[model samples]
Target chain A: MLVNRVKELRAKYNLTQGELAKKIGVTRQTIVSLEKGSYTPSLLLAMNIAEVFNEPIEKIFIKREEEE
Target chain B: MRLYITVILRTLLYISLAIMVYDFVRIEQQFELLGRGYIDSFSVNVGNQVGQVFIVITIILVIMNVFQLFVMKRNKRAKVEDYILPEYDASDERSVEITGKAVRFAFVFILLYSFLILGSYMFVPNYFLDFVWYPMFTTASIPIIGLIVYLISFKIIYSR
Candidate 1:
């Protein structure tokens, strides 16, 4: 599974979901899904998110083993 | 201007759908009346012709409206970098995921429902055919049920 610190980074940047979504050219619901871990974003989206937060991709997203 | 066009197209689409439904209901009523020996054959033919015209116009309008919607979405996404877009051809990934899940759920629901109907028919062969309108009602309800199932599932899945 891919886990992400999107919510944390979004908060650090003091950006609402709508603002972040607009900056990244996505709907606000996508950001909500990303934070809730219900949707796995593409690598390009991950890079865009990293770019917005000025963080490394690895720092923003982590790959972990699935829990049984 | 784009929003205005979209709104107009949507309104027209709804009007076309309403007209089609009205036409269908009228034709069905005529058929029922004919079966009861109340309507003449010439009247039935005229009603069918009117229904056919409405069906053709509605189908054309639906196709045009869908094309317009696709164009509008593509234009909106054109502002974003091409490389940044998702793998799917649509506007966003999340919408695609939600749609995918919803369609899967609806497909399964329809499949199960059809199987149940088939199973019931094996025991009572004449049950469905006894009512002339039953098949039409079932056919019409499939899409409605699918849409309802999709909306409910989408809400539950996305709200979490």
Candidate 2:
């Protein structure tokens, strides 16, 4: 599973889901999915999101071990 | 200007769909008139031909609108700014994935349903065979059923 600090960082930056999504060339639903951990974005999308947040990709996204 | 173009494209799409519905109704009415002996066979045939032409035109309009919508979405993405655009990327990866899953599920469902339908024809051949267009109707229904299933599954999956 991929964990993300997108929601946290978005909140810190006072950006709404739609705002963040538009800045990254994605839909608001994509941001919602990423925040909810329901969808794993491609490397390009992750990098774009990181750029939008002005942070490193590793800082925004982390891989978590699957829970049995 | 871009927003107006999007609105115009949407309006055209709706108008084309409306025309399709109108043509379908006209065809159905012509068929009914023929059955009631109100219209001759030649008139019915002409009505069907016209309806077919309208259908083709509607299909072309739909395709054009879809292409325009895609272009509009790409433009919006390229010009992303503080303001939120009303456009959506219908062919996004997540949407495509969900649609693929829905299509596969619908295909399996339709296959099983077809088997059941075919099996029923064996026992009630007379009932099913009474309609000369039974096979055609069933064949046409496959895509409709698939579309319904796709929409339902998409709703369910996306809700999560």
Candidate 3:
């Protein structure tokens, strides 16, 4: 019951997954999985990613419909 | 960086092993001389040198082991928040299990190596055995035990 705005945020920044990962000191695959939504980012990672995109945490990640 | 570190460590190990071999040959020759009722001064110097080499090697290996532990701990931390599994796929489970078994197999090899060296010491020759056993047992056991512990935890968590 978690949704992520990974694609939207990446597009807004005009960054590839590898570029984002390099900026954040993580692997490119991490960005791919974030977009796929199969993997959940930890609180720390979510905060970092949100900060990188210059968006509110709530804007970057929303609870799924059922959870709401 | 890891590669460079490993190379440096391996060089240290080799140098220590070579010194150990040199000492062992000296000891054997000195023992033969003592059997003939002659004391060899040069052999005593070689023996002391051998001990020094052993101490140096022990220190190097201990440092290297600590370095490996730090690297592994960092890797685990990075995995925590840095990435996600693409799917809750069966393959992930299988990969974990297969790697677990591989680790267990490596343990068995260590046990075999120890037994073989012990047997050789008691029967054939004692040279080079000391150089081999400490690193073999310590390095192999850490991952073997860690993987086994991880596998047990996974079984408990996922069984439900």
Candidate 4:
């Protein structure tokens, strides 16, 4: 299972899903899908999102317990 | 992705049609030369050269079109799979096999053609090979070869 830091990181920066999606060059629905654990970002996309949060990728997105 | 493949194949068909029309005109010119009392073998040689060259070009274009289809399909599938199933890596073994089969089929076809030509040289001395044979054989076989290639590539690209 995948865990997306989208909601938490977006809230930390006081940004809406649309705003976060615009920053990452993807559609709003892509952000929505990511947060809902229905999609996984490519390596480049994940890296871009991590940079937006000013944190390492591991901090924003953690694997679920079942996945571990 | 399917739309992209259809467009590419249609373009290839148009190009092949143009090449065939050009070859037909050239063949008529060769026939005119023969009517003017040229050496008996002159038209045959010229016809053979032009026909073979045209067939080879058409085959090359067809192969290129096939490659384009593969790349387009692969890109679209990769994108969709990335969104839907991140853990599973797409298997490319079928694609590899299809490529191998296409190459092998091409080799076998050429080998058989060569054997037939050599046999005509030995046993059927009176039956002369004409220039039209190349284009006729190629035009006829393109569909056969294309069907085989499409089947293999389809199995490879879509199986997984």
How does residue B42 of candidate 2 score in lDDT? 40
Predicted complexes: DockQ each = 0.49, 0.45, 0.06, 0.04
For candidate 3, the C-alpha RMSD (Å) to the true structure equals 11.1
The Cα error of candidate 2 at residue B61, in Å, is 5.4
Model 2, A1-59: lDDT tens digits are 89999999999999999898778777687788888999888898888888888999999
Better of 2 and 4 by lDDT: 2
Each model's C-alpha lDDT? 0.65, 0.64, 0.56, 0.56
Give a tens-digit lDDT track for model 3, residues A1-20. 78999898899889998898
Q: What is the DockQ score, from 0 to 1, of model 3?
A: 0.06
Provide the lowest-lDDT 10-residue window in model 1 chain A: A24-33
Candidate 1 chain B weakest ten by summed lDDT: B80-89
Q: Which residue pairs collide in model 4, if any?
A: none
Clashing pairs in 1: none
Task: Give a tens-digit lDDT track for model 2, residues B1-160.
Answer: 3333443444444444444555555567667778999778744323455446546655664565566555655654332221122222243556545655766787888888787767765665665224434444455455556555655676566555
Cα deviation of A64, candidate 2, in Å:
1.5
Which regions of candidate 4 deviate over 4 angstroms? A7-18, A26-39, A42-44, A65-68, B1-160
lDDT for model 4 comes to 0.56
> How many residue pairs of model 2 clash at the backbone?
0
Measured with C-alpha atoms, the lDDT of residue B112 in candidate 1 is 81
Model 3: per-residue Cα lDDT at residue B60:
68
By descending DockQ, how would the candidates be arranged?
1, 2, 3, 4
